[model samples]
Target: MPGKHVRFSRNTHFQSPPTPALSFSSISPASSYAPLTPPVIPNNYLPGPSPYTIGYAPIPKAPTIRVHPVLEYSSHQNVDFDILNHPSSITKNRRLLSSLVLSEPATSTPLRSMVITCPHLPWIITVYPQSGSHITVYDVFYEIYRSLHKSITSSDFASLPSDSARRASTRAYEQRYSRHRSSRHRDEEKRSGMLRIDFLMGMTRFAGLSPTGRGPDVWQLNIR
Candidate 1:
């Protein structure tokens, strides 16, 4: 058996298999893959001021503070000599007297008005001020005691209406005077004199004297 011969044309060519177009149903879901994100950068990477920001912020101001003036003794420019001298005037103006005494400087001199002759006694008690010398509660007290003692010991004090009244007055005066002689006394005697002065001035109890505590000599007057 003879086979038939097959011949191909010069223009005849063989082609590769055509690629198929991808369909939506055939594609995988985007959730299956990880999401894309920007890279992380450190704070020190920029090494300069931010472009969005301006100059440095203003500094806050400090709060204002008010300081009060300290209370101190004043010079006796407005003191009335007549009122300061008279016992009756002192009795009438106990509060005013207290204020005046409290404001007096410790180194202040005894005014001439402080000198007085005892009405009930024959003695004249005087406080003489010396240059550059300071006075203390003790000195004032001593003068007051002398004046009070002279009065209490006089015939006039003994001639009070009732004997009981006279005895009470004597006992009171002695009790006050005896405190100075006590061993435990500090400035107690002076305090007693202050009380006596207040009583004589007709005040039930006036403000008391206080030590400045800065020194043994420094004293402050307290007014209530």
Candidate 2:
């Protein structure tokens, strides 16, 4: 065999130049002078209306409320006695009283009345309107009978002594020996000027100031 032809093939591949390492310190001061730009917002994105803008105002709306019928004066006077017996009706009575006093006026007559029965016995309280926004409780009497039509004294009067007189008798009894009790009695005497009864329910201020609520025999109406 002829001597094998020895041939050596030359390796021909292009070699790229080595890249330079980049750093903040390595960057020139002049090259850093270029401004940093904000990130580009996507094409589909949009800013919403501002809260302070008039165009974004809240829609006006009338409240959807079940307006309960105004409790008429007739219905009010004819209150069930069972409601007075039950403690749950206190809240209802409060609400009704407030609504009647504030929203619905006693327009028909010069005087208007409603009854709320005491737990055990029937007591009639007479209220008189004073010059100031105050009510003076003239008298409170215990009733003998539950009669609505007949006069308070004729059929129902039981002649109970006034609260003030009872209070005075108690105070006098207490101040017999104690000097402190005597001083307190004097203070109480000064404080016992007028029985200013103020009934505040919700926003209603039950001051004896209305003409319809004034006048004599206002307490004749059966509350219970």
Candidate 3:
């Protein structure tokens, strides 16, 4: 390319854009900005009192045990209680026996079974009334008392239910046989001490008026 004119400087220095100067103003005395310090939680410092109110739920208490009522029932028929006087007089059929005092009323129809057990006797007298008759008839069952040699105090005996009467009877039995006490007998008594009566159907059968089994004609009373 012809006729091109070019101009050059003798200073020989690289040209660059000039940077603008920066200015800083003095911090205001009234300004809130200050050096960072740890957060100041009132009432809280090293080994100092805490601000939070800590608490816990209360613990639950155990349930109280239930005590059963005393047995107070009356026998209407004047049957001879002595086994010697009447051998076959234990069962009372059509006996109009009614409970004088009951914790709960007879919820269903009247159905009662009487069991007469004595501490001194070796036999249990059970009177089952014939349906619709309620007269006295007797049956003697072999009394198989668990040989437990533990005597309960009169105080304890009075508070306990008739179901616990067996325990008392067993204790009485143990006392009578205490004269011939031996190590073997003591061990056996200790083992049998834990045994208790399974059921106590007072004045009435616990399972009153219900179909008992696979028989159509058979029925039972679910009385507790």
Q: Pick the candidate with the highest TM-score.
A: 1
In model 1, which regions exceed 4 Å deviation? 1-113, 116-125, 130-142, 149-154, 173-224
Tens digits of per-residue lDDT for model 1, 23-130: 111112222334558688897787566678655544553322111111122342222222112222333233343433422332322222233332222344454322
TM-score of each: 0.25, 0.18, 0.18
lDDT of 3 by residue, 10-105 (tens): 222222122222211222222233455867767754665789997755555322211111121223322222211122222334342222221122
- Cα deviation at 141, candidate 1, in Å, is 4.6
Q: Pairs clashing in candidate 2?
A: 115-223
Best by lDDT: 1
Q: All models: lDDT?
A: 0.32, 0.25, 0.29
Poorly placed runs, candidate 3 (over 4 Å): 1-114, 117-177, 194-224
Give the clash total for candidate 3.
Answer: 30
TM-score of candidate 2 against the unseen true structure: 0.18
Candidate 2 positional error at 152, Å: 19
lDDT of 2 by residue, 72-176 (tens): 224332222221112113233434323223222222222233332222224444332222222211111111111211122212222224545434433432232
